[model samples]
Target: MKGRETLSNRFEDGVLALLPRLRRFAIGLSRDRSDGDDLCQMTIERALSRRESYEPGTRLDSWMYRIMRNLWIDEQRARQRRSQTFASEEAGVSIGAVGGQEAAVEINDVDRALTSLPDDQREAVLLVMVEGYSYREAAEIVGCPVGTLNSRLVRGRDALLAKLGEVA
Candidate 1:
């Protein structure tokens, strides 16, 4: 009982400490403040609820990030499915009219470019560029050899440059 209590306290402290970074990550994934807040809340709730699944001495932040990433992917899939039914209707809506239109357009362009990338390249860009992970850390997170990660980074950068051209 004492051991469990101590572990719980530590986990709570860790989660509290990581909240700001987690929120930032969620915001990057969601692109909406409300959605990001919800995602962060969901992540914290899930982490606390499943505390037993966490291995002590492991990288809690990485584990939490994986969970958050999976959740975001699932949410994106759900949104895709929902949008499919209204795709034609939504298609006519100009991206230009969105709130923060210019910024949204830029984000959309980046997202489209990102989606066009091969999976490994996209993942590498997201991990290193968006999330600020070091190359070695990203390689570990993506479960790839360092050389492979370097190759992906080079290819992805070239692809982005080609897509963005002089506009970026």
Candidate 2:
């Protein structure tokens, strides 16, 4: 019982310690603020419930990221399935009905730019660029080879620059 308590404490500590970074990564991945918050909540809940699967000596952040990525993918698939009944093609035009031009306009533009990226490219950029993970580490987190990850970084960067109007 004491050993289990120690492990539980460690898991909780791990979650708390990495929460900020995890939430940022979630935002980058989900692109929608609400969806990102929900994703982070779901990831934390899943990680705590599945604590036995965690290896004590491994990188907790990476493990947590893996959980988040998998959950995000699952959620996307579910959303796709449920949206089949509706015409998603038309829904893209319905921006959230925000009023006036404020600082949030820039933030929304950035989010839209990031979200427009392909899944692999977006994840690669988020890990390598946003989170400051190494190429090898980011590749491992995304379950891709280093070369593929590098390619994704280049593609993602180019796409982002084009979309965000950094390169005229």
Candidate 3:
């Protein structure tokens, strides 16, 4: 049907428009660019395949994020069952030249600080601080109460500041 085709085209466009944000979230979760790319691709594929289930006029970004988070959790469980560890620091080395050493170092330090947080805290920080999600939206994404999300954010923010020596 022409109507269905049009809707599909629109959905695809929406998904495409969200690719960069999704990729960034994936990379933040996986902590390796290669794995993050794979996760991002998987999320896009799954969203496209399941487009029929998506409700029109709802938050498409939220739907995509739920899919990504579910997939990441599944992969993590599988890896745990297989006794696979995360890649080493060397494995996370950036491929391209640094744009600026000072900025790069600061970014790396923040990333390192984030990685040091617990999984829940990291997710909280990523969704709120990094992705700019509202407390209610992020709480919904992570399937937690807004109060819990706020608590996690507070703890995560404090830990990051401590790790970065930003608290004098």
- Scored by TM-score, the top model is 1
Name the runs in model 2 displaced over 4 angstroms. 87-168
- Model 3 lDDT, full chain set: 0.89
Encode model 3's per-residue lDDT on 1-168: one tens digit a residue: 999899888999999999999999999999999999999999999998889999999999999999999989877865763443344567658643467797788888998999999999999999888766668768978999999999999999999999999622
Rank the candidate models, highest lDDT first.
3, 2, 1
Q: If the candidates were sorted by their TM-score against the true structure, best first, what order would they fall in?
A: 1, 2, 3
Per-residue accuracy of model 2 over 1-168 as CA lDDT, tens digit each: 999898888889879999999999999999998999999999999998888899899999999999999989877865764565354666756654465576578778888999999999999998878766669768877888999999999999999999989722
lDDT of 1: 0.86
Q: Pick the candidate with the highest lDDT.
A: 3
Off by over 4 Å in 1: 86-168
User: What does candidate 1's lDDT look like per residue over 1-168, in tens digits?
Assistant: 999899999999999999999999999999999999999998998898989999999999998999899879867865765565344756768744666877887888888888999999999988877766668768978999988998998899899979977457
Once model 1 is optimally superposed onto the true structure by TM-score, how far is the C-alpha of residue 115 displaced, in angstroms?
Answer: 40
Considering TM-score, which of the candidate structures 1 and 2 is the better prediction for this target? 1
lDDT by candidate, in order shown: 0.86, 0.87, 0.89
Instruction: Kindly give the stretch of ten consecutive residues in candidate 2 with the minimal lDDT sum.
Output: 81-90
Alpha-carbon error at 110 in model 3, in Å?
Answer: 52
